[model samples]
Target: MEQLTFSSAQEILGFLDSALGRDLLLVPVWMRNLAYRLACLQEPDNTALLRRAASDLQFVGPDWNDTAHQLLRSAEALEAARRDGGLGH
Candidate 1:
């Protein structure tokens, strides 16, 4: 399968919204992760986006266990940092 690439968050969001609208549960896990990764690249310090991406991956089930775990860890670390005042508000 050809990999899907996104130049911006709007493109990813549009794809995801369309998928959700069509009830397309068959959207590949890698594609979902790619969207999340691209969004992260655009806004690396957005903890809320990280958490939402992790939750979104979890919602897709366990096909990509390592990627899901990594996202969860990243979100947790960012949340912890924010709580500890490691990240400036």
Candidate 2:
């Protein structure tokens, strides 16, 4: 497994998007896990996590920026997992 270095929700989302492009079903499980992890790391409604996630993406590979945008498109899907009492929250 590749080691992930996400410090915010955006980075997680970006990572998720990249994973999804490879294989939707397979990436969701891990992406959701990372999302939950990122959410947990957040300061409870504070946008610091989002900001951090954005910053983290900059530290990643160039493709991560595009990945982040793709993930942004699937916010509802990600949130749905959280609403269903998934891992991130």
lDDT of 2 at 2: 34
Alpha carbon deviation, residue 38, candidate 2 (Å)? 1.8
Measured by C-alpha RMSD in angstroms, how accurate is candidate 1?
A: 3.1
For all candidates in order, the CA lDDT equals 0.73, 0.52
Clashes of each: 0, 1
38 Cα displacement, candidate 1 (Å): 1.0
TM per candidate = 0.66, 0.33
Tell me the lDDT of candidate 2: 0.52
lDDT of 1 at 11: 69
Best by TM-score: 1
Model 1 misses residue 69 by how many Å?
A: 2.3
